[model samples]
Target: MSLPMLRASRALSGADMHAESHAGAYADSCSSAGRVVARGAFARFATTLALTGALFASLVASPAVDAKTAQPKPVLDASAVATPDRYAADAAQQMFAAGGNAVDAAVAIAFTLAVTYPDAGNIGGGGFMTVYMDGKPYFLDYREKAPQSATRDMYLDDKGNVIKGMSLVGHRAVAVPGTVDGMWEAQKRFGKLKWKQVLAPAIKYATDGFPVEPWLQKRREFAAQNFGGKTNFDAYFSNLKAGVVFRQPELAQTLTRIASDGGREFYEGQTADLIARQMYGHGLLTKSDLVQYKAVWRQPVTASWNGYQIVTAPPPSSGGIGLIQLLKMKADLKPQFDGVELNSEPYIHLVSQIEDRVFADRQQYMGDPDSYRVPVDKLIDDAYLAKRVEDITPDEVPGAVPVKPGLGDSMPEKAQTTHFSVVDKWGNAVSNTYTLNGPFGSGVVVDGGGFVLNDEMDDFEIKAGVANQFGVTSGDVNTIAPGRRPLSSMAPTILTKDGKVSLVIGTPGGSRIFTSIFQVMTNLYDFNMPPADALAAMRFHHQLLPQKTIYFEPYHPIDGELAEQLKTRGYTLQGQTFNGDVQMIRIDGTTPQPAADPRGVGVGRVIQ
Candidate 1:
């Protein structure tokens, strides 16, 4: 069947909702990739939504956030891309210059990171992609999946106590990756440039070598401190340092093969063999596991607030749901914030309060829908949100009121992840958030493939009701299971005004991804700050557990009087600047204003 027809067929059959047994046999050949819009498909979908009007509003928009106001000055009308590293962004622009669309640029960007920013970027890790084409959205979940050998209590010891590093520090921590398949699917179905051309830039960098910046050097130092004596770390990163040229000749060879043979080479051919062989004695991965891995095309979760539509990656990622819940609660309680200063004690307290409560709900309910039913519908339900607001005792110190999660349950560390935003002149935009799970990722580089493996296994709930290293509490919903995708806080989001793409944003801060993205959006759309200011603004975060403690970025604007007020209200404050780096692009009219967050060494620019 043709790509769109295939998508329609799967959508109709409901088979695309989750993976089925024996699916690996035909998934790659038929359903794993390709959702290419058959010429008129997008138009049909758009018209259908327009015709349905308010009936589709629930699916398309939420009414909590205010509408975006008009920009005061004219902005550039051009394609733009941003990544946590400069070279990756340059590679994305190169793809755009080669006549690639946003999907192509994004694919190129993702691969380039694997070469240039080896700390977080990888062939072994996985992530989520939020794509917008002709004002419609598509979610591609390339997030890592557990191997067939994985079990729910694997992280627990014989005595049933959680093992501290079992899930975070070795070959066994690796999950079957889906990034290659995900990018391939995007390019095959929606890319405007040749796959080979898209892979060329990354291959060139990997083979020819690229200079390590101070940030990369710092990352190398940190990895050395933690994983110094390990064979895997020494092999791939021992020689890495600032000003030194870093090259991945083996990775270059691998990319060359992938560029010529397609991503199948990585999943089913020599590359897969290399990964399996290297991980054999230390982990459970096998060539069969690689063959069975598939990247699913999901539907983005959307919420309407402030006259604009917010579209983000859905579950297995609690980021979007938590975002929607927090914003909805904030909007529901707007009457209380009227005339209050943005970062004033009252305003800060309110946002923190919302974060605490929403995170509580997330810990109880959100997880991989294929493994468990994540009551997303009720979590974002209008009535339920209103009740959550009513339960909030805003004036009292937060912990004193004992705000608990409402009915229905949900569902660390400096994130060793990278995010990039790309918008093409054709009005196609993609926000991709991916990771290695830890800096250098289990510190295990695939033997001959020259790529680090992800420790995403640690992302699962090793101990029920306890918070993981990233300060995210978990339950059965997030427990590990064979073939199940683990929960992630990667919120790659796209915003639309009326019906056109307005903003694309994402970040990499483990549990802080959602809150960082949330703050940036509100700063731009709600508070009307420019893209730079929006991203550079000081940020604060509060997860539900370890109640009453609010973490803020260093020298955060809230201090003195505001800090005093927060303290008086029973909130404990802690500050740190390394929350997460947010890369964002504000698309107003003709130009896409891209902002690389200053918190990290990212760079942003428009591709002419």
Candidate 2:
């Protein structure tokens, strides 16, 4: 099963708590690390909201934060393969130049970033991948599964209630990793490039080192305490210095092994032994667990919204079902989806109501199929979905959002994750989201080798009501069980028109993953905005529990006093600079226009 779907919970608003620290505490260190703001936090709104004292005061005292320096974009036409991040793009370009097709290029890009971009994706983590080739979608079950020792009660206390908080810090939280086999089997099925060729880009970055982008460098500083301590920090963060370039020799070496020998090295060879030994030291994983790893392939799920077919990450991952449910709830409303306007309160409110109603079902009925029988079809059946929408009151008040009675009140989780997208010239598109729960996952570095183990165990539903790293919650549908894959908010997707591929997309944000995809789709297919403008826009999100919209001021302002007014109705308010890295490719029937999210330190370019 995928990692246990422990619910996500909002981390402490670290808003007011970290405001001073964000500006002062890390200023010197960030500057030293070559980290610039990348982009300043968006401006604050003028409102008499209860949180106004803190919100307005911070803005009044601060100048706009510095934006990160912009990297150059590829000046090209549509046929060049488009990837969300630069390393992935470079990897694909190498394959394309070597006479490899999009499938080979994409595989190369995915493997390359697995070494270079480790915050969210890599061998430590696993996810679903949909290949658009052979004129049909081929679903691969690469999602991770629970261990042989896991059981239905793994996450339950004697009384059966979920243990509190993120399942991150311990050994019990991990599931068998399937990423290696998933990628290998995928290449066998569709990749055109030789295995070693696909692995080269990652090998180069890991060995020679890739410069730290502002966002990645900033994350290291913000979450330094979490990713590493004074001990063994260099193993994962080698050659990195503020304003100084860093290289990943260890990771490059690991990739070289995989490229030449295959993923078995990570599961059965010396590298695998290194990982097992480390896990044993930490009391978290065992060799038996790694030996049992296998990838499963399942069908992708879809729902039609105004003639456009939206495909998403399916079960094991609750995202696909969750997204359809939310859209179902709002199916009747005539949204002002004209792509030209900035995000609005009505948009935020509708999404919140949809979230509130759908979460109840998600918590009760979803889980890894190998262990639990989720009523997927019924859950997404139009009739059931319509009822979910009916629960919406169309008002911004707290209780107006619906929840299924008897299910415990919902919570949220927020783990940092990564996303990548690829669209080959042949029209096969792949959107993927992967994560290790937190930075430098588990912080259990492989001795004498590069790459950190995943703290994905924290991704389980350990404690019932407490917020984990990401604000999320989990219960029966997502509780840990042997062989069960945890529920996830990772919603990688593709949008199609008349049964043909139209656009491919994916992003990085824990609980916000759902909202980010939802909004982006609205902006594109519904709002009809251009790639860059759609990406640069701000966003707002609400998971049933917070009860209030979490707004990014610059783009999602409530307009008028509705935001301030919502406070009296029990809405919890919080704000942040723009978040979510949405990398997408639009095949407008004639050409492909790729857009990379400016909010993150990712690079996406057309393959020359």
Candidate 3:
């Protein structure tokens, strides 16, 4: 009989049999060598019969399955990595294949990105790393610190007015880098591979060159146009083009030195001399600043939310407090969202309102904990957040002027950042978000280092209450101070369920980082959407200062009716070209399902 007819015949014959009976029959068919030849035929027949029964049962049980049920089953028994670039993902997979744990893969990915994705990934920039290992959470704060010469009003003029572009492009804009030290510290503490092994892929890419993708090409063109002839930027990046091999011999040498001498090479060795020399006359950083820069291990900001344990970046990053507060407020107001469809008019309005409140609190209360007292515990207190959101109404939107910081205490770090998530077979996970603050940060490449320095000085509040390039305003708590880390929005987060890593996720979008993460979490837990759909879902952002305006992604435009409904409720709907690039992995029963944001040229790989 034909295959279809055979399947149909089995389906009919097994119509009255229980699924257990089919399983028993299949086992019986494989019970002896005499039945070996018939194994294939019996197996096929049993599988067909089982599937037909399952389909019929499902159809009869629920005619209209929700998105959660309709989604494909999670990939089983595999490790995964999700990153903003294909090459970085491949590098991470190589480490995994070589018997590396999550930390090793993470360290490998970080270094590789410095070579393949230089716009944000950098040895000269710094960011946060959240790691879950040995049933514990750890946060590494290698965020760039202000130079010792940095002062509160350094970016201001004789007239006390803020100078435009002073803090965005030049040697003066660069902060002391900590990425090399951060990676080294993480590897030393948790990695299973040798430091040289972790950095091999990056050195290979830098030495052998990698293909210039469209995103890197665009960044190079932009740098050339705006920062041409400014410094070594033009000398190095001016010639790179798309679809060509872009090699950085100087960078390869620097990476090799770093691999050989360890992270100290960048902070105290010849690399430090090169950086100090590059900034000597025109900038604030000195070799002393580089030498003093140290990546700190801080306790991760953690909370329990809806049965999942949240582990994320602590102070210096407003992300952890912001995320916890948002989640808390959402939970407190859960009753108001009953019957509202996800991403509907009411849903967007409610979420935006909650976000605005959090942003308000962030502006007033968040800062580098070492330099200023950030009341993290008080900021995320359920009672404080309750009071912060108690005034919200479904129909009326609050004006920006009226939204003051709930507790007077005060932060954007930049959207031009990159994030990656990794998971290994042993269940350890890492969510890392690093940045240069702006594209090709500071637009100042080290003369011999061939790496971009961060424009993170712009992240500090150059002038309190004044909006920065990303339109996020902050207060005095975030003002610059010597050796202080700027308040950051980079929240690399991990979530655990029942003591196992459930989610490893993070993204790059200046002021929108935490909100983007919050929304994704809600999508996964609240809406029960699969990882892929949850990531691809439309995203909107509100920073409270943009005042009554809700920024939605143009790529995922709001429905006409929903937009009109939101407008009728006093919201100014604005479309931003991009919201965020979220790289995440969802672990379901020890299997990982990786999802890369569709908005960028990223890849999500499942490693067998």
Candidate No. with top lDDT: 3
Q: How do all the candidates rank in terms of lDDT, highest first?
A: 3, 1, 2
lDDT of candidate 3 over 1-608, digit per residue (tens) = 22233224533322212211100000000011112333353444445445555543332222122335333333248779998787788777767665567887888788888877877778888999999987789999999999999999999999999998889888999999988899889989987656666776675565446777777778778866766567557666655667877665556556656665677878887779889999999999999999999999999998888999999989899988899999999998888888888888888888888888898888877788886767777787878888887887776555734777787531322216899999877778899999888877888877756778889999999996788768987687788889989989999999998878999999999988999999999999999999989988888888887688888897698758888988887888988867899999999887799999998888999998
For each candidate in the order shown, give its overall lDDT on alpha carbons.
0.74, 0.58, 0.77
How do the residues 166-186 of candidate 1 rate in per-residue lDDT, one tens digit apiece? Answer: 788788888998888888888
RMSD of each: 13.3, 15.1, 18.2
TM-score of 1: 0.85
- The per-prediction tally of clashing pairs is 23, 59, 5
Q: What's the lDDT of the predicted structure labeled candidate 3?
A: 0.77
Instruction: Give candidate 1 misplaced runs (Cα > 4 Å).
Output: 1-76, 409-415, 555-559
| Model 2 Cα lDDT, one tens digit per residue, 27-140 | 001011111211021011111122434542343233231335332232224335444456667666656665555566656666666655655556766767766664576566
Q: Residue 270's C-alpha lDDT in candidate 2?
A: 56
